[model samples]
Target: MAEFTFSTEQQELRKAVRRFAADNFDEETVRRLMESDPRFDPKVWARLGAELGVLGLAVPESAGGVGGTLVDQAVAVEELGAALACGPLFGTVYLAIPALVAASAGAARDELLPELIEGRKTAAFAVADQAGAFDPAAVTLTATDGDVTVSGTVARVVDADAADVILVAANGSGGVGLYAVDAAAAQRTNLVTLDLTRPQADLEFASAPAQLIAGPDEAERVITHALQVGSVLLAVEQVGASQHLLDIAVEYAKTRLQFGRPIGSFQAVKHRLADLLVDVEHARSTAYHAVWALTDGSDDPALAASIAQATCSAAFSRVARDAIQTLGGIGFTWEHQAHLYFKRATTDAALLGSAEQHRDRVAKLVLDTAAVERVPEVAVGSPR
Candidate 1:
């Protein structure tokens, strides 16, 4: 409803999160975590739940949460991405929780939301098809007589190994629906991803016992809405990462000397950094608009989300690349932190949907809306 500018309270929240991240997720800490299997500290996750109230930021108060808005969640995620915070927080907050909230009110929401909000349980949404599409019709899991089974492997299942429960999309006799499956019931193998900070897994389900959360009529709409939410929040994360990379590049240019002069003084370096600054600011605006659309129940959330994804995804990737170039050879070294952001940018650009896919979505929406608008004119011009 309101403009995208952050309120005083929101600014304070962002500042607090940035401070927390600086203390806990420094470069040394990130490097150490990457060397570990889980790639995230349980203590840090616990602190996020206990101190930051991040787990429940988007959940409703009736569901045992803090009753925060999507914008609030976006603010938190932006800071987390800037800090390169590693954990299952994104999958839980952006995907799993949203799916539960979108489902028809039932035992699933009642029993699961509380645990999720309290961070006692973590969940991942297993909706992406083999080819990485998030379409409900793309779901390969089958269900019959209240039992759901998935045989084929689902790829890029974020945080699957760490999740206690998985909210799976499946097609049943009743049609498409959301199903809850315990992690132990499914076989999981961690996949080696370019971004080690955010691990993924391939899950195999064989006749896994599952409870239906929403039936065919509501399944597609619910899943699509959840995805839009994820996309918007993910765009916010990209903006944060882009801003951080820009900051790193500019600082390096100022300090690093070339031929007895600061590299920042060079016209080439200044132009590159200036271009990156414009892109990052544009991406931030797009992400914020999408967040506002979601929070305010705008008529065209799909359009808003697709635009944000299409714009921010490419913007972040480009910024990351340019940042690395600005820093010279050191940016390419594994020991340097620039590579981490580059990997994250590449991975995140393909996380939910690629930039090309989102651009297609935007094109379709615009054309469809234009067609609808033309119908009125066509009818008025015709003899009646």
Candidate 2:
């Protein structure tokens, strides 16, 4: 087993996030958000975004950020997942900002990055159609005349209503490109989504004007960055959900008696819970590796990301289902909150890309790298 160690700063950040989530984003707040029309409480979001500076964690110092890395952001993601809060922070901060930072340079980045760091503007990655195929080549949206006109609709975008800017991936002259579209110019139709807590929308661009932020090849560049960051961050969130599920299951097992004693004392329950612990720990190692690679500029960030996403997705889903089973009848009730975590876990597992997709990518990457190693270098006239 790999050992886990955290720096003092990382530990402090995690503690602060845990306290904030526990205080503000409890079960009652989550229920209220789910029931409400717009979905989240603005005050709580402001506190998280503006007060705590959660949105700026991954942004660089040149862009007015605190100069933190993906690992720092991952720590906060865990807390947010644990709370099950309904906010646009993840979509804006994790997906959009990272993509922008990775893709743009010069004047555009100078103008956009600072605004994002300050939380004055919100951005979303407008990938993924109704089919949930997040491929760059699968994008049906079109951007013509270099940057002037954009057409086609993007389905199921996270936090589309709150966005000031949207990073749109579309088919352009030289292959797939990324454009920074001003949200006010486009037509946004809010959708009745399954996960009500997280607001989603369908956006239409009828020859909408956009700025050419990233030229051709930008879609792959930006999506790769988004996936690399999201894969690890999503795993952190899964860690939080899995831990929360375990805690809930343990408490329920202790209080709810079966066969005259606490059900937790049963060998079957004990073994199952023990197995869950092992899965969670395994996920922790892979997630930590992914974050570390992203932060340290490792050679294989994408491969690390695929491994983490695949492992963490499985761990979270299993933990969530087992938790529901452990709670028996009450877990199935709408009033009970176990189902909320379960649903969120399911949705998040399929975000960015599915676990099966990631596994396939991982396999190809490994084989490709192995094949590259078989070719021997020849010195001018020396070796064949």
Candidate 3:
């Protein structure tokens, strides 16, 4: 097992992010901000990036960003997830940044990265087409390049309206290529998504002029790696959310009275809270392992990432549902923040890929390989 520890700088970053969350993500503030158009305040995002530099945590120093690592980015994202933050952080930083980083070096990479680092522009990666699986086979969108144009509809694109540019995965003559399109050129229709805090949009492109980021040869590899990065970070985000839910549920159990005594005194309520603790801790372990794998470039980061997503998604969803149950009627109520957390839990589970999807991937990677590796040779003459 690998050792786990945090640096002093990372600890300070945690404190700063916690303070930011407390001030900006208090229940009332989150509700107010999410209710607004765009679902996130640009000024607040600017402050988060240009001031704290959290958005630039994993960006290269040459891009005028904080010279930091993916673990730093994961730490910040985990904090934001605990707060149930409503912003462009997931779309811009987690998804789009990795896509840009994985693409071949070009003018678009040079210009756009600095813009995102400075909070001057927000970007979203087009994960899948209408079919909804984020693989090369699902990349049905086509691009023709007399002048490099993309056409097709991508459904459920995260933060589509909030983005200034979109990194589109489309089939081109060279093969599957990654193209960049200005948001202004594409038509966006807002979706009535489950999580209001994280809005999504359906985008329609009709020969929208685009800039090629990754050629056919590299596009598949680039998108696969970026999604792995997103899966790991999102697992950590689930951990943060699960821990918060567990804390609140425990507090409620301790104080909420039933049958002339605190509910926590009873065995059933105690068992429920205890189970949540186990789930939260398990989620933390898996999430952190994936982060380590990603930062260190482990032998099989994809397997680690898929396992983390599978474990954390189920854990967080259960934590949210049971926390709501622990709270009884209040958990089901609209005014309570428990439902908000539940919404985030369910949405995150299905956002990039569901728990079922990742579990299938995990089984394929582990079981298929084990079956092949376990084959033993028999002595032809000695055995009967």
- TM-score for each model: 0.92, 0.90, 0.93
In model 1, how large is the Cα lDDT of residue 195?
Answer: 89
Q: What would the per-residue lDDT of candidate 1 be over residues 26-73, giving only the tens digit for each residue?
A: 999998997796678877877787678877787777767777878888
Q: How would you encode candidate 3's per-residue C-alpha lDDT over 1-384 as one tens digit per residue? A: 658898999999999999999988888888987788978878888888888888878766765568788889889999999999888877788778877766667997778877887778898888672211256788858997653999999888888977999999888887888888999999999888788899889999999999988888777767766777788888999999899988999998889998889999999999988988988899888888777766765536667777888899999999999999999999999999999999999998887678888788778778876443232211110111
lDDT of 2 at 24: 83
Residues 151-199, candidate 2, lDDT per residue (tens digit)? 8998878888668788788888787777778898779898776666677
lDDT of 2 at 366: 89
Candidates sorted on lDDT, descending = 3, 1, 2
Candidate 2 steric clashes: 0
CA lDDT of 357 in candidate 1?
83
Query: Clashing residue pairs in candidate 1, if any?
Result: none
What's the lDDT for candidate 3? 0.82
Query: What lDDT score goes with residue 30 in model 2?
Result: 87
Q: Where does candidate 1 stray beyond 4 Å?
A: 129-134, 148-152, 369-384
lDDT for predicted candidate 2 compared with the true structure: 0.76
Best model per lDDT: 3
